[model samples]
Target chain A: MLVIDNLKASINGKQILKGISLHVKEGEVHAIMGPNGSGKSTLAAILAGREFAAIDGGSVSYFGRNLLDMAPEERSRDGLFLGFQYPIEIPGVSMVNFMKTAINEHRKYRGLEPLSASDFLKLMREKKELVEIDSTLTNRSVNEGFSGGEKKKNEIFQMAMLEPRLAILDETDSGLDIDALRIVANGVNKLKRKDSSVIVITHYQRLLDFIVPDVVHVLYDGRIVKTAGKELALELEEKGYDWIKKEAEKTEESWRVNPQ
Target chain B: MNGNICQGGLFTLQESTVSENMENDSDKILDEVTSGDYKYGFYTDIEADQIAKGLNEDVVRMISQRKGEPGWLLEFRLRAYRHWLTMKMPGWANLKIPEIDYQDIIYYSAPRQKVAPGSLDEIDPELKKTFDRLGIPLDEQKHLSGVAVDAVMDSVSVATTFRETLAEMGIIFSSFSEAVKEYPDLVKRYLGSVVPYTDNYFAALNSAVFSDGSFCYIPKGVRCPMELSTYFRINAANTGQFERTLLVADEESYVSYLEGCTAPMRDENQLHAAVVEIVSERGAEVKYATVQNWYPGDKNGRGGIYNFVTKRGICKGDNSKISWTQVETGSAITWKYPSCILKGDNSVGEFYSVAVTNNHQQADTGTKMIHIGRNTRSTIVSKGISAGVSQNSYRGLVKVLKKASGARNFSQCDSLLLGDKCGAHTFPYIEVDNQTAVIEHEATTSKIGEDQIFYCNQRGISTEDAIGLIVNGYAREVINKLPMEFAVEAQKLLQISLEGSVG
Candidate 1:
């Protein structure tokens, strides 16, 4: 469903994501695990078409189309969703209105008519139930005055509303209590379809336990240093990332010596 | 949108590069909006009877004589004119007003007609086309059914539709000149009863040279069935529009009045000093709304209208109420305070305003709520949006006298800045002499954040529409207070004024 080739990105002359390559097939779930400053979130941002970081090299393709050239909104309209690690708080913009505008924009891009008021409310009710988000939260301004857990759950609610083909979840497990984490993960799992894929970007394997992944990759020093299966996440959780850091250091030293 | 937004999560710092891009995008939008074409700048060609330029006792007399006013009214204008000469222009507002040459402005300029049009067919086709272009047709059949319009061009009210029907209901709705002749007693009694000529500098000048405006009266125990509206247009060059509107609601009566103003584009500044006074008797209610869209000069702020207006209302009897709602989005320099005098026990006053300024425009507007009698109440809500290199400020005052025991007042003023070049300010003064009085004030200033824009952009909404959404949400509280017809116009004006026609 998505392929990223040797993606390179930087911010203010400081490189964030080094050369990185990854591919995800339809219905496959990929868990990208890393410690802080490993550029996991940066990779997710670049994939979602954020322009903050300068794309130094390489390319990203989604459904055989150049994803990097598309704008963030265009990417969203084309079924590319990025669940923000820190959901923004837009005061005075109701969640219902925001979701409705977003859904209508996507539908417009697909040459479909906007949802009628009743149809929109019905769809909202359905998504609300699927994500376990109450009407009070959905009725209020977008993420305004919401608890950390509620904000994350609202992200999932939006995801359920959009029904993207590929959703890159960035630290959905962060700042979430165990119950809230379970609910969020359950929402994502419920929305999973045979033609859809998910990239769960988290620092720990706790989220993966709820929405298990088909493959696991360890990103260290802006590079994907390890790629394996679900067992790799458990192994990384048990021993932590010290071993991977050491391995990354040795590989960097080798690259410096060989000048590649 | 980026890991930069995740630095500390929730509310985080933006990258300098990202902010630089945002700055460019915002600057571009500000440029576009500031340089936006004035859609109502088209001029109409018709013969106009104009007086010689300059302000003097004779000019004031000429205006009164031209209107064929009574001798007592002529004395009132002459007295106000002499007093205006003795007074100096007030300079307290937060604005850089250019020195205005009163001698260079024509005090009176009216369409040359033998008499007030006896019917719509007698009206000038050019004038009719002008109003039609402004979305305000003079033909009652083509007009909104619920609104009775008085179309004022230059210095005279051309036509006031539904007048006969309104007369049947005992609602006196007609031009000021007509009212002075038909209901001389009512006009003389309530003309300066609410806002006297001696109230301020502009009030005195407007009282002296004001040529034409609308006059409305809702008699005892009657409610106005239709919205009474006045559409003022400055079609003649070098002429100032001094319109005086007087509205009186008798005991147990109710009325809602709307006023809208526009002007053709000119290379020289035009002066518009208008005075609006409304009075509500016992158990009566009055609502006054205005959508002021005067020409706001060019991109370089070369020429526009100097809008110096005085608008006030009085609750003259117990249980009476007066509410003011205005959406001001034009004028090179705007200075107005639509205030209320709560003189009766248990009276109420409310003010809801949304003022937007772009380019080199400057606006310093708010309201004053004076509590005089016991148990009076007032509420004030203001929203200011500043874009380009403009300056927007909310200056308001709430005073509770010693006799106003148990009085309550709440005021909220919020300002939103669109770009770094623009500015927003709030100045609120509160005085409570009564120990039992309660006053609450809340103020906040916010700039449109890059994160907010990006969030909307990520949702497939353009930056312009995002700003519109945010601004509309910010001003919803005030816009919702307008009458149904004005509320819709206010919303569309807000969108077009600041965000442009994009999206």
Candidate 2:
């Protein structure tokens, strides 16, 4: 469903994602694990078309179309969803109104009629139940004064509302207690389908335990140096990232020698 | 006295341009706003009894003589004219007032009606059409829901509907001229009670040449059955509109009055100096609302209305209440501060305002709350929105006198800036002489967050509609205070005024 080849990206002249390559097929859940400053979030941001980072080299293809050429909103309309690590707080903009505009816009892009008021409200209720979002929270300004748990859950609620084909959860487990983490992971698990895919980017392997990934990739120094199955997450968690660091260093030395 | 002084310099921080492209974007947005047609710019083809372009004691007298006022009224105008000559134009506001050629402006320009219309049908069809185009229904049968309209064209009250119906309830609603002729006692008693002739530079000028406005009086113990509204239109060229509106709510009475103004597009800036005085007696309540949409000059700020208006209400009896709600979205240079004087014990005063300026429009508006009686309370909620190189300031004063024991006041002034070139300022002055008084003031300044815009854009709403929604939400506190029909109109006006103000 998504493919990235040798994605070289930088922000403000500092190369963040050096030479990264990844691919995900339909219905497969991929977990990208990395330590701090390993460019895990940068990959998610680049895929979502955030303009702050410059793509120096490489290509990201989504459903056989070049995703980098599209605007951020167009990417969203094209079924690319990024769950922000830190959700934006939009004061005076109710979540209900925000979701309505987003849903209608996406429908418009797909040549579908907008939802009626009753149907929209019904959809909101159904989605709220999926994520356990409070009805009052949906009426309030989007994430304004929301608790950390509420914000993460709201993101999932929005993901349910949009029903994107591919969803990238960036550090969704951060700032969430164990209960919230379980609820968020459960919500994502329910939204999974045979035609949809999920990319879970996290520094910790805790989130993967709830929404178990089929493939696990360790990103180090802007490159994915290790790929394995669900057992890799448990092995890395037990051994910590020190082993991964030494392996990444050896790979870097070999790449320098080979000049590939 | 020290607390009454607001300490701040206007335009202290120079805005830094982020990029040439951003500057160009702002200019393009402003161009879009200015390109929109001024829907109320059409003029009536009626001949006017226009006085020569000049202002002096003699000109003031001619206006009084034309109105055929009593000697006392003429003397009042002459006194105000003399006082105006001695005073210099006030430069305290954060505005650039291009030296107004007072002598070059025609002080009086009344449309020459062949005969005074006795009813709506007798009114000139062309004049009625002008109001119709402005969306002001003058025909009683087609009036806005329950709003009784007093349509003022040029410098005269053209048609006043539902007058007889209101008169039957002892609610005297008529033109200022008619009031002066028939109900002279009420007109003379409260003409300048709240805002006196010598209140300020503009008030003095308005007093000297004030041609026509609405006069409403709700009798004792009576509640006005319908909304009383006055629509002022400036249609003539080179004419300075000076309208004076007076409203009085007798003991135990209640009334809600609305004033709306608009002027046709003009190259040379036309002056609109108006004075509105309101009085609320014992146990009486008065709510005054204004939606001022004067012609704001084009992108380059070439032409528009120089709106200098003085509006105030006095709570003269115990338990009286007065509220001023204004939605100001136009005018090139607006200097207005509708205030309230809480003079009676336990009286209440409120000022809710939303001032929007775009495309070189400069507005320095707020309100004054003077607490003179014990337990008197006031609340001020002001929202200022500036876009496109415009400047919007909220300068307010809340004074608690020595004898105003237990007086309380709460004020919140927020500014929302749309672009880098625009500016927002707040200067709140608070004074308390009594130790028992409690006052709280909060102010905040915020720009339209880029993240907020992106969030909206990602959802499918266009940048323009997103800004409209955000701005309406910001001003909802003040706009919600408007009457039901006016609230919808105010929201639409805010959207139109801020169109293309954001990228």
For each of the candidates, what fraction of the native contacts does it recover?
A: 0.45, 0.31
Report per-prediction Cα RMSD to one decimal.
2.7, 5.0
Alpha-carbon deviation at A103 in model 1, angstroms: 2.6
Worst 10 residues of 1 chain B by lDDT: B1-10
Enumerate residue pairs that collide in model 1.
none
Please give, for residues A1-260, the per-residue lDDT of candidate 2 as tens digits. Answer: 79999999866567878988889999999999988778887788678764546689999899999988987778888888888787767766678778888899899999999999999999999999988878899989888788989999999999999998999998899989999999999999999989999999887888988999999999998889899999999989999999999998998899899986
| Model 2, span B168-285: residue lDDT tens | 9999998898899999988888887788778889999999999999999998999999999999999999999999899999999999989898988888999999999989999999
Candidate 1 per-residue C-alpha lDDT over A34-61 given as tens digits, one digit per residue, 9 for 90 to 100: 9988888778877876666788998888
Could you tell me the TM-score of candidate 2?
0.92
The DockQ-derived docking category for candidate 2 is acceptable
Best by DockQ: 1
Quote each prediction's TM-score: 0.94, 0.92
